[model samples]
Target chain A: AQTVTQSQPEMSVQEAETVTLSCTYDTSENNYYLFWYKQPPSRQMILVIRQEAYKQQNATENRFSVNFQKAAKSFSLKISDSQLGDTAMYFCALQKAAGNKLTFGGGTRVLVKP
Target chain B: DAGVTQSPTHLIKTRGQHVTLRCSPISGHKSVSWYQQVLGQGPQFIFQYYEKEERGRGNFPDRFSARQFPNYSSELNVNALLLGDSALYLCASGYRWGEETQYFGPGTRLLVL
Candidate 1:
């Protein structure tokens, strides 16, 4: 079974600054996918960014990027030029190539301060 | 295009009761999946249906079941509900069974007393 861990339960970043949310996972699969999802107060879960294990380059989506370290089993999300809209609960997820189910981390609550 | 849509934004039930949650996937999407998100916890996979066929199931007990329709819509049924069952039920859809991205719906909040 794969497990994802988000050590920080809460985080805050000033507007226009950057913040990084840490994530780690345990999985034996060599090929898989890592994803960061944002759930706002509206209760809608949105995909932030995704990284493929076989791809060395990190995934970037607008102001959202990921730092994926496969050997360390770490996948962290970085939000640059953060805005108030970035405030939400961020979750790290893992899915193996052979499976459709996603294993998610506890989540990190981020607050962007103006 | 509209995203995944779930019915009954909120529902309340009692122990030993039953509840049925519905979901309509994005147009042209053939894969629909169900998840339960307990307060303060990440969403847990419940079931996955592709092309009206059961493709995957999680560790949930037999009390929980789900099925997909030909239109790619789905329903999740829970029987003998327990208080522990009270949570946000989320529905997700993908273009295919193994597609990388699974778009999530707003979710139906279920409360069991």
Candidate 2:
């Protein structure tokens, strides 16, 4: 079974600052992938960033990056230089290396203050 | 070049009613997956199709069903809808299935009355 947990229900950050959302997941598979998806008021699930479990280095894209601790089963997302548009619901997801299903967390709502 | 697309951007149905949501995958993509996102929660996987075959199914009941067409388009059917069934239906497409970074559509919002 695969389970994901996002402890924070909500988070706030000022513009140009940084905010980190925490997530912990458990999966039986040895190889898998982790992802962060953002859902704004538009209700569309947009892919933010993803990391392969086997990769030792964390994955970063533009201002979005992840701190992936394989041993601890932690994958946290860091949004730097936050903008007002960054306000949204962020979800952490996990997919197995040999499976198609993606198990997701309870999501964290982020509010970016201008 | 177009991304995944879903039809009937919004819908409303009463209890015991049936609803069908459609999805069109990106060009050349072969896999499509369905998810249900209730308000203030994360999306829950429903179904996945690859090469017009059922690849995976989630914990949903028999009231939920889906099918994929030869063109890689898909439809999600929900019968005997209940208030709890109301949610945002998301469709994602990827090159294949496992380990693929799926791209999602705008989603279909269904309100069960």
Candidate 3:
């Protein structure tokens, strides 16, 4: 079974600064997908960014980007120009090519302080 | 377009009771998945349905069951509920099973006493 781990339980970043949430996973599958999801106080889960294991280049979405190291089994999410709206719980998830379900990390709580 | 929508934003039930949660996927979506998110934890997959057929199921016990309708809507049924069953139930929809990104609904918060 594949499992995702987020070591940091809580993180804080000043407005306009950058924050990085670390994530690691254990998977034997050669091809898989890594995703970062954000859930605000409203409890709405939103996809932040996604990275395909086969892609060497990291995925970037607006101010959100990912540092994916397949060999190290690490996939970290970087939020740049952090705004107050970024305050939420971030989760790292993994899904194999042939799998229908996603394995999610424990999650990291981020607070963007102004 | 509206995103995934779930019914009964909140619910309360007792042990040995049964609860049914409904979800309406985004228009044109054929895949619906159910997840349970306990407090302080990430969402855990419960079931996945595609084209009104059961495609996958998680490690949940038989007490948790779900089915999809021809309209792509879905319902999650839980019987003999335990206090441990109290959590936020989320419904997600995608273009196809394990094909693209899945959009989640606001979720229905279930409280079992």
**Cα lDDT computed for each candidate against the true fold:** 0.93, 0.95, 0.93
Off by over 4 Å in 2: none
True contacts kept of each: 0.60, 0.81, 0.62
Clashing pairs for model 1 are none
The model with the greatest lDDT is 2
Candidate 2 TM-score, true structure as reference: 0.98
Q: Write the per-residue lDDT of candidate 3 for residues A7-83, one digit (tens) a residue.
A: 99999999999999999999999988899999999999998998889999999999999999999999999999999
The TM-scores, chain A only, for the candidates as listed are 0.98, 0.98, 0.98
C-alpha root-mean-square deviation, each candidate: 0.9, 0.8, 0.9
lDDT score, candidate 3, position B112: 97
Listed per model in order, the count of residue pairs whose N, CA or C atoms clash below 3 Å is 0, 0, 0
For all candidates listed, what's the TM-score of chain B alone? 0.98, 0.98, 0.98
Which ten contiguous residues of candidate 3 chain B have the minimum total lDDT?
B94-103
Off by over 4 Å in 3: none
lDDT of 2 by residue, B1-113 (tens): 88999999999999999999999999999999999999888999999999999999999999999999999999999999999999999999998878899989999999999
Model 3 residue A65 CA deviation in Å = 0.6
